[model samples]
Target: MTIAIRMPPDVQSVQIGEQAVVFIDDFLTEPTEMVEAACQSQFSPCPGYEQGKGYPGLRATAPSEYSLRLVELLEPLIKINFQVPEQLDLNKSACEFSLTTVAPDRLGVMQRTPHFDSSSPYHMAVLLYLCGPEHGGTGFYRHKATGFQRITSENLQTYSDVYSDELHRAPPKPRYFDDSDDHFQFLGMMPARFNRLVVYPGSLLHSACINPGIGVCADPRRGRLTVNTFFDS
Candidate 1:
């Protein structure tokens, strides 16, 4: 399942609020090799959005060679489609192997909601799904109150104020955020597929659609395994 470099990698775009989310199938020639490599690597708890205890699982930094290769292969398309300038800094970018393990009920309020990687529109996140569909995919969200589908520096304060108020007024259920709720509306999900790669602006509101049926597991082979990478200008 190898999608050739073909300049920018073959892509299918899904427009979400003026943003183009590019998804590609058959992204890796040897995805299993990468999976096995990750399984044998060291992993630790990934810091969360607020309280230093957010992500439900463990993570390990991806090999530098692998990150360099991906940046080399995807930069041209990112520059053109995302309109990033030539001086886009790779220093802000990172690549990591992640696995979701914490149960839905064990999650914090922050983990139960959607999040943006950065406030800058120039920040892009490239996610490679190394597991099967049973593991679930990523879902984009829109704030019901502010009607904000994208979170930027300009709207951050406004969105956060309204969101915080709503949470205090009426708390959300302690469960995974895969569907619509009182605050955020579920727009759609990019279904997970083995060796599938998708890239989108990190500013967009998004959450991992952790399948409650599968629960939590630390094993990379049995759990949800993903290659998370970020780039910003």
Candidate 2:
């Protein structure tokens, strides 16, 4: 179900399951500009993923400038009475934010992998697309029994079995195979538009869908440029 809340004249909020994703028309003007600056600044390689490296990125260059604006705009939605406890703290809440530029090759393997978020109930994630919808969109899913929806690559990294290429690599997990009849129920897909931000429980199961019939290097330009953060309540 889609529920809408007006933050004011131009900004709006939408809640899907336990996740609250807020959208601000021109709210990201400054933050977007900051991100562009970071992309060119002395960037850092992303922590775990070898395939990804953030140019100086926002996390270091001008983090306070980049995050304060986002925190301010999202404060209203964060203060709402959500079911998850980790997403409720207003005064003590903290988040890890970064700028990401996904190369085309990495996006291919990601599409076929289904993963879970390992964060406990106290953590949620927000992803802001700095690019356009044509790049790639965020996919959300509802896990059985768990009821949690809207997953991302960050969530899958929690399970060692999923990340270790050698363990579950060659044959693939039985559950992920077609014959297993295992499939995630689609919760929703976040639009990949500039300034479009998607926030959801970090523990949800989600993944990025690969562009069909496209080679990794065919159009390296087709990948996504996103700024993401993980919040703890």
Candidate 3:
């Protein structure tokens, strides 16, 4: 099967906290191929996100071609919007289709809070929602203690120190984090829509706002299936 992205992707720009977020609708000419591919692949527990920390879900490999074309098509926009270098190496990127399969009982304390992927300014995250609004959307947050909207190397230590102190005082509950809490404040949520693509900095404090009522469904066609890619230099 052939894959193609929409020409001059219907891009919209927005700010989530201090990060530049790009939302593209009708991103692919054949998005169902991605869903079909996910339906066919075997999924496994989402392993350690950082330093062997458990993530709340299941994940499977995605089509490499999708990753390649996505970056190629968004090159100019990414440079201007994300404020990155002109050269983006797809070889340095990653692609995956993940399903939010964790139940509250199975969630880890760390997985219940918002997280930044890396401290590097160059790192970026691109996600394509393959489900309906009922599945939920992605949210940006602010660390209430540190007032950190986007954690950078200069403030990573400060953020970490404050977060560690809070973690011990009161561990996060075993459930998907929604709006606000004592530690993190939700800035806003980018609603998930079928075939909608969203991108933001990896340093932004963010989390998936998984719907509690839907529980967990492994079926890609029915659950919160998403294409998550880390695009960087």
Candidate 4:
């Protein structure tokens, strides 16, 4: 089957605090059938968190054709929207099909909270929603104490100190970060829409709003299927 890919005339962007989130609707013309087949065909259990907390989900190596096409479509946007150099270095670029697996109760203290994919401002994440709205969306947060939305090298120590202190004072319960917790405030939310893509800095504090009732399917087609990519300039 030939996959249909569509690009909007102009991508929409939203700025929250210091973070700029780019959104593109109807990103894939009609990719559900093809992508779902690919995801269900082969998948491996996602690796444990780097800090050895808990596994978030499962991932499958995406097809090279799809990966190459995605990079081609996103590179120019990244350059223009994020203001990266014209000459892009994609040595660290990766494309994969991801599915959420671990339940909220199983999440570790760290997993229960929002997190940054990386602390480098140069790094960015692109997430394409493959499922419908029943699957939860993504959220951006602000660390209430420091008023910091994106953690960086300069503020990492301060963020860490505050985070540690908060954890000690009142530990997070066994659930995904919802509204304003003691430490983080919900700055904004991006609802999950089929064929929608969201791009934001990797340093931003964000989390996937897992719909406990709907999104926990182990089956990729029925679960919260998202194409997650990371790029470093």
Candidate 4 on 1-233: residue-level lDDT in tens?
Answer: 44545855348999876778998888877767656555556766676743436448777766566677677777778888988888767444657788877777777788888888888867889888988888878889999999889889999999999898988888799887757787888988888988888998889999998897778766877888888889886
* lDDT of candidate model 2 versus the reference: 0.48
Q: Candidate 3's residue-wise lDDT over 1-233, tens digit each? A: 56698887778988776667889998889999999999988888776643326556789988878877876876666778876766655334667888877677667777889999988887778899999899889989999988998989899999999998888899988878878998999999999999999988888999899887773777899888998887666
Q: Indicate the residue-level lDDT of 117 in model 2.
A: 48
What pairs collide in candidate 3? none
Off by over 4 Å in 1: 1-8, 48-52, 90-92
lDDT of 1 by residue, 105-218 (tens): 777777778988889878889999988999889999999999998999999999989988987888677788898887888888888998888999899999999887673677
The stretch of ten residues in a row with the least summed lDDT in candidate 3 is: 47-56
Q: lDDT (0-100) at residue 100 of candidate 2? A: 35
What clash count goes with each model?
0, 8, 0, 0
Best model number under TM-score: 3
RMSD of 3: 2.1
Q: Candidate 4, which segments miss by more than 4 Å at Cα?
A: 1-4, 8-10, 49-55
| Cα error, candidate 3, residue 38 (Å) | 0.8
Q: Considering only N, C-alpha and C atoms within 3 Å, which residue pairs clash in candidate 4?
A: none
Task: Report the candidate with higher TM-score, 2 versus 3.
Answer: 3
